[model samples]
Structures are given as C-alpha cells and as structure tokens.
Target: MSEQAKENPILEVESVHVAYGRVQAVRDVSFSVPEGGLIALVGANGAGKSSVLAAVSGLVRPGSGRIRLEGKDITRWPAHKRVGAGLVLVPEGRQILGTLTVAENLRLGAHRRRRQAAPESEMYELFPVLAERRALPASALSGGEQQMLAIARAMIARPRVVLLDEPSMGLAPKMVDEVFAVIERIRASGVTVVLVEQNARRALRAADTGHVLETGAIAHSGPAAHLLKDPRVVKAYLGVE
Candidate 1:
C-alpha cells in the first residue's frame, strides 16, 4: 500500500460478513477506497454487491468485522448518521418519490445537512435535462432522467464517499454511456466513489481499481486496467472474444 493510501482511506471494509436471518449475503468481503478514487465492485446478480454497499451505508449491519471511514469506526452507526458523516448510497432503481417534483425530491436528499448541500446549479450543470424538468413530478422523468436525478440527489448531500449501485441497469446503451460519463465527472469532482455494477466492462473502465465478487466472496481484486485485460475477467464478465 502507498503512504498516501495509508494516510487517506476514505472508506474501509475489513472482513465484512452480512446476512439476513439464516441466509448470508456477503462473506468476508473486504476492500478500501483511497480519497478521491473510484473503486468498482462487479459481479452477477446475487453476488452480494449490493449487500456490501448496504453495509457501508449502515442500511444493514455486518454480522462481524469492521467498517471505517477516514479511519474511524462506523460499523454501528445508523443510516442517517452515516449520511451525515459523508457516506451516502445511491441504491439500485432510482428510488425518487413519484409524487414529488424533481426539485422537491432533490431537496429531501439534503435533509441531513441542508447547509452543506451542493447548490442546485451544480446538479443542473451535470444533468441539464434535470434543470429543465425541475418542476415536473419525478415519475414523469424518463428512465435515464430518473437515474440522473438519483445521482444528482446523492450529490446534493455533498457526500465524501458515494456508494453507487447499478447506475447503468435498465438504461439504453446511449443512456448507459451518458451515465458512465457523469460518473467520470463525479470522480473528477474529488468525491471518492464505490461503484457496484453488473456492467463489468464499463465499471472497470471507469474505476481506478476493481474487485470481482462471486457468490458473496471476493474472487479477484486488482488495478482496473489490469482487470480489464485479464483473460478470466474478460471471458467471464466482459463478454470479450
């Protein structure tokens, strides 16, 4: 590990195990994100990608092991507390309130720390279509627009680390490209990102490092560029010849 990594890990998951009743969803999964780095967690459905994000965001408790943010233990923190502490999760499926106007839904994201929220102008700049539809109900937005809104809402909270789950799911190919571009911009803006996606090729391309999870355990972990070219990764996840 580099000295810079040691000095500034924005998030750390150490031997995390997560479960629901008798069923375990994640087993001994571990990774770390350096400040301002983008880490991609890629796997098929039921590989426990979302479970890890849920645990990091405090939406679910780990049965064992520790979760730390900037080196402080946050394993027992509540979801709202985690958000306030600069860890936010943009869950799969743009869960914007259907009845609320786009602006209203976005304001709700800042409920934890209104004073620290990013300005609406910043979000508008990222997704210009959103600015034009700010007054419309969130349900009225197209699939890609709703996804953009979900990302914008998370950004409004000014989180230090964003756990993004399946941002490209259910989008057209063009929309997926657009979303990936926005994700790149998000990383450029200096926020650490942990992206969980089944879109392995795109996710690995966008990330600084990549981890491959299989059946709740980390199967492979390394630099994103190397993973992209790895024969096993390309054959199993990237669908390359």
Candidate 2:
C-alpha cells in the first residue's frame, strides 16, 4: 500500500445518529475504517448495525453528526452521489439482478466512464468463477456464487470503501468461509471494508477491528484480537461456556 493511503482513513463516521420514523436506529455512533483494513460491526438484530451501514451508504440520513470520505463531509450526499464519490454498498440479501446474466450484471455496476475492458479482466482475476459463469443468468448460480458476484460487481465500481451488510447471513458454513476469504482479499487490495455480521465470533475473527452495537449505540470498540480475548465480548456475543 502507498504511504499516503496508510496515513489517511478512507471513511469516517463521527458521532452519527439515525432514526426511522419515531424509532432511533443509531445513537452517536463513531468509527473509522483505515484505507486498507477490514473493520467489523457486530451486534444482534435491531442493534443499529445495519442502520450505520445504511447511513454511510446514504440510504438512511443521519439525524445528526457527520460522515467523511477522505476527510470531506458527505453527511448530506445522496446514495448515487456517494457511489460517485468512491463509496459503495453491497447491501444485504446479495441484491443481484436475477434475470440478468453474470456479465450483464457486472456491466451495470460500472459507471459510463469506467466501462472498460480492464474491469472485466480485473473482476476475472478477483473471481475466476465469475468468468466461468459469465453467460449464466444470475438466478442460476449457487448462493455463494451469487454473493461473490454481488461483491465483484461492487468492486468493479473501483470503490475506495465498501460497506458490506450481513454478508454471512443465511449461508452454509463452507460458503461463509468463502465469503470471508473474499473479504480478506478485498482488504489486501487496499479497499477499506466496513462489514456488519450477525455472526459476531466469526466477524471479530475476520476483522482488524470490531465494534459492538446495542440498542442503537456502540457499546464497545477495539482491536479484533483483543476483543476476541475479552471475557465480556465472548460471553455476550461469542457464547462462551
């Protein structure tokens, strides 16, 4: 990684609060993802983990505080504009186009300016299975492949930071491993990842840092290694016996 990249964070959420109607979803959440690290957000459902991701991706507006990309305030930016600013979200449910061919879906991911031959080659490198199944309709692929394609499509946009929500949800054990491997590779390639996972133990293991959310607020935040060894974290989230 470049020295400059290591010196600056790609995304920063500072004291953000978000609400839906009368219910507050995120309360004063603050965290930073460095340019090339996997940062995990772990919590039970309705703990505001997804809320934070939505707020970062512009799907949900923060009622207070600021979001910065490369140190620029982007709290008020819309979703499409956030993508243009090199922030992308691979939303939950692997929202692939079921009727579209794998190649077609990937093509849709690129902006008009970035629809070059090089992106296809890059994606093929990141996901060889995608190259093999490029002609198949997205619906025909296995669950893991669909998730891989969803991630590869996001990467095709050349985003600096990618927000992944519940990436391991509803997948088989082997498939979960495959998905986490892909996440590690993305971070190795210098893309900052803000990952939310219901599988708290696995999430903390895969991330460089982990944050625990409870009732719309961050209850704890620290290095993943340290958090893994923490008794409270293990007892509460990891189900320690």
Candidate 3:
C-alpha cells in the first residue's frame, strides 16, 4: 500500500547468523520488512526458515549481526520484551491452551502489555468460527480451528508486526484455503507479516515478496509475482508443471 518513494521498512535484519552447537542454521541472512507488507520464507524442512523467524522473534538468539525494529537495535532483547515492543510470534505449531475456552484464551492473549488490542467483539467478527465456539474448550477444535485461534490470539494483542511459522502445516486442503484467506485479511489490516511456510506456491501467492531458502541461505529473492513465475522456482519449489 506504500507508494514506492516514501516506503520505509519497519523491521530490518542485518547480516544475522544462527547456530546450534556445531551446526550453522542461518548464514549472514538479511532482509527488511516494510510496514503493512507480507513477506514469505519458503523452503523444504531444515532450510532454516523457522530458525530465521525464531531469531527475529527473540525465541532463539542469533550468534551475530543485528536485528532492528523501527530502526532501533533489539538483538539482545528478550522474547517478552520484543512482544511488548509490538512484535509477536505465532510459532510453528498452533500452541493453543487445550484446557481453556476459546474466549478465555483470547482474553489471556491481550495481556496488560498490549499497546492496543482488538476487542473481543471485533475478533469474533474477524473469526466467526471462533465466535461460534467461543465457550468450547480449545481441545475440542479441529487442527484448522486451533490454527485460527492461534492467529486470533496474536492479533488480539495488536502487534505492529507478526511472525507466523508454518501456519498451514498439518492442515486439510479446505482449511489451508481458510488460513490463507485469514492471512490476506491480516495483511490488509496493515500489520506487517513474516510468514514461513512449507507450501511454497500458496505462500508465494500470498506474499508481497518471496525468499527461497536452501541450506540456511537465500537461494532466490524477488517480488512474489516474479518468484511465482520464475521457471527455476516453479520447478524446484512451487511444485507446478
């Protein structure tokens, strides 16, 4: 939505590296996320897409380089601190509290730290299924329903940017469609999004920009439309004929 000239990035990852003991997971990777834009990191498992997202969310500390939010370095900040600073991560799996009712889980997500969270009424409007089962225990929901609850939980916190890792993992085909629809709505709401998904085609289709990762490094980077149409990308990642 930003007219090219004045577009400024809200988050920047500069030469970031992440390691797990002897294994290097991310190798000097860097990218910028513009405010209200959606970027996707797509690759096979072990390609380090999740690791990069973890580093950004402060769920895992990068071995080196800088992570900035609104141009302020936050590489050393803790996870909760980053959340308080308007960053939230809906991690790899939908991590809803199984015992709590859907409404209770939503209320908990809007902790005192939220600068401005969506009202429960608005969340119900955004996720009608959640509203339909508002009083049901989280465990009663299907995998797709749980994913919706997970996303709603994050959105209720009103983060400036959200990091979503593998949101479509383990979802049914119809559910995957619904999840993507919600993602588009999230982007339209002006919240910057960083998505890591294994379904390359769908992810690229939903993104403003797409980055293909291989062996912990970016193998391709371009506008989403370009990446989707790239012959090599189509053959190697998109799984289309």
Clashing residue pairs in all predictions, respectively, total 0, 0, 0
Candidate 2: stretches off by over 4 Å:
1-7, 112-118
TM-score of every prediction relative to native:
0.97, 0.94, 0.96
lDDT, candidate 1, 92-133, per-residue tens: 997989999999988998887687898888889888999999
RMSD of each: 1.5, 1.9, 1.3
Give, for candidate 2, the lowest lDDT window spanning 10 residues. 111-120
Query: What is model 1's C-alpha RMSD?
Result: 1.5
Give a tens-digit lDDT track for model 3, residues 6-26. 267898999999999999999
Off by over 4 Å in 1: 1-7
* Model 3 Cα shift for residue 18 (angstroms): 0.3
Candidate maximizing lDDT: 1
- Which TM-score value belongs to model 2? 0.94
